[model samples]
Target: MTIMQEITTDSDQRQPIITLQGITRSFGPVQALRGISLALKPGRALALVGESGCGKTSCARIIARMDRPSTGDLYFRGRQFTSSQSSEDEKTYRRAVQMVFQDPFAALNPVFTVAHHLARPMLLHGHAKTRSEVAARVAALLASVDLEGQSTAGKFPHELSGGQRQRVNIARALAVEPDVLVADEPTSMLDVSIRLGILELLSEIKRQRNLALLYITHDIATAAHVAEEMIVMFAGQMIEWGDTRTIIAEARHPYTRLLLSAVPDPDRPFVPGESVEFLRHAEAIRKVSRDASAAIEQIGPNHFTRSVTL
Candidate 1:
């Protein structure tokens, strides 16, 4: 299957909610993103996976409109969003694309109650008007994320666990009825046991709301759970990407294979000096992956990988 075919997954023929074409972001001499391109269609999730400093957050920032791409075109509903857009248009785009940050605690206001956080967005976005209407909407939003409306509301951020706080952040994002949801490592700050719950919540919300989701994380293992398609980034460039199960089952790039190797094997017993050997192997993979090349090799019907320069 091609990207277009994959885009029409589950037989949905809707156009992509957002598309990034050859996106690049530069900070003076340093380039954070290199020719990044992907399309986010409604009712589908795309996972962006890579190690730290591999431009995952940069891509998310550009998608969220928090940062502009140095070069490249960003299209929303097939129309390019240019710098000349009116403030109202910009606001509309921002409202349509909501982001859930990595730091759940920082995303919420400690002084405000959960009701206040969820109510503010709905009120500002005209989703609700009267106080009663806002309250009802807030309760519905909290309930959607599996939080008990009456029990969870009226509590401050410090009063909630990391997982609960992240759920609240998600509810806050959904309060605006966004068309796209960008979750940048939403579970990284929470306990390991609770991470799966957050991922499940995101997947459920995406399917239920038909919201295009960009699930960005360094953890490749979680990609298979929440996303149908996946991209592996190395040194700011996409080295391999395609159908999540296809790539996960038959990864082609060295970096991609390295990432898979890094996933902990519960059945394998620890061997002495294994850590040293693994680190050495990782360094070797990184060295070759860093050698930039624009050559892309098609690996399968929907799978593709960058050609490494030896």
Candidate 2:
């Protein structure tokens, strides 16, 4: 039972910019995270999928340096980082990894315009100096996220739609020129019609900036849209993980199957009384998935699923 297994896609062979080895977190008597290990490589996105209270955001916070692991080591570019790191090193790590929070409106300053939100980070990170330079960088950031700089930048967060505000949040994250982007439920708050657009925007940003992206969400279906790789987590443990397409096509874990089953299939129209059966099956899967196991089985070249005691 290896605690750390090398998980890489065929397209991404480059070294991981960030790595988490056997990470665990505890809140007094409660365990928030359990033996988490994964790597985030540049130019690729890894989707951390799980329902609420499954430690997905905990992983993101650890990677973004918002919280420290109760156990396990964190590595940046293969070098182990510590809480006692020098101020310079801390600053470098913070700037290198930026987060796009779940609530787009709350993430921004209401008093300030969209341009202010984007330009402040650029100037603070030394990406821009003069006023003209800041303006240019702000416009460029907005443009990269598919937002029109002239019309969008001057508007307040309240003035924009849910999806547009989210785009602005992403642009603000990019303003720092971060190597790693941790997006926590980037589109869960937006309208369903616009969710795919945000997902596409994230995919494009990952490729163009060559960013090591950590996309956190409970929706497994959307994970396939943005991430090259995926990890399905349950009860603070990774139940299944691998290439996104592989897991979607052939999910081995019961919990993974339950999640996929919940996704509405256009081909399978709703039938009366099916919901009751699904709830019963879903409960059974949850009971089995709650039991943790250190052992894992390889399902494909890059895919793996935990050994569940059925």
Candidate 3:
């Protein structure tokens, strides 16, 4: 099948800046995304957490227009179009939404200065005027990402630390003044100590600029750190999702609990005479979660868990 045939539908909504309905992708035999659906509202973030190959990056690429789904409804802003969009339309859609990938180190070229990277996006999207205008805008972008324009704009990506490079990536995404930001494993590549700094920057952007953000990661702990709402994915399907606090406190699905249980505890809990019997049960739960046909059931306000049979 061609690219357009891969993604099923185009159903936009007026309320959401971006929406995905029944999004499912298959690599011939392997289903990458199993009818995944989520909406990104302006000024809020939804954390998509899952193990690698659990469809987080696939979802990111689909939303970024870099990849397409096998069968699903995609919406921009209250409009409906055929899944097979013209090249021009695709370009337009990409300009409205942008992505920050996991490896900030690899996302940029070693030779290009920070100015060159940020300036290109601004010029490509017509966010800047002449070279001088591009310079000014690039500086502003650097500042927005909490980097020093004077020092950063002149430095190459390699000269910057992982945190700084990620900042530059975020700034480059904002260079186009996009409504949606898709961050896939954004902080996983950075030093653990600096991860919070990057998360804080994203939060500040959402609050100040009213940008909708999608934070895709495997780290559930950090999901609560950045996103107000969360969706936990396993085996290419959502297992548990709801308010960040609610999902954390009232986890129902075996996968969700297992994930939470896997979180390294500084003060590890001791089980009373239960020498990991729950672990065998946990492995069984994972095996069951590997199936993609589980139904979804709402357990609380905006909280949902996968209904796995057998």
Query: In candidate 1, residue 104 scores what lDDT?
Result: 95
RMSD of each: 3.4, 2.6, 5.0
Return the candidate ranking by TM-score, descending.
2, 1, 3
| TM-score against native, each model | 0.92, 0.94, 0.90
- Answer with 1 or 2, whichever has the higher TM-score: 2
Off by over 4 Å in 3: 1-14, 268-275
Per-residue lDDT tens digits for candidate 2, residues 1-310, read: 4646546534567889898988999999878898888989999899999999999998899998989999998999989984558989998998999999999879988899999999888888799999999988888899999999999989998999989999999998998899999999998888889999998999999999899999999998889889989999998888899899998888778788778877786585223224545557777778888776546888788889887754
Task: Name the candidate that leads on TM-score.
Answer: 2
Candidate 1, run of 10 with poorest lDDT: 1-10
lDDT of 3 by residue, 252-300 (tens): 7777777777777547522222335666687688899987666667676
The model with the greater TM-score, 2 or 3, is 2
| Residues 1-310, model 1: lDDT tens digits | 3333333343445689898878889999888898788889899999999999999999999998888999988888988894548889888998999999999999998889999999888888899999899988988999999999998999999999999999999999999999999999999999999999999999999999999999999989899899998889988888888889988888778788777767786564222223545556777778888766557777776788877743
Task: Provide the overall lDDT of each model, using Cα atoms, as 2-decimal numbers.
Answer: 0.86, 0.86, 0.81
- Kindly give the stretch of ten consecutive residues in candidate 2 with the minimal lDDT sum: 268-277
Off by over 4 Å in 1: 1-13, 268-280
Per-residue lDDT, model 3, residue 130, is: 91
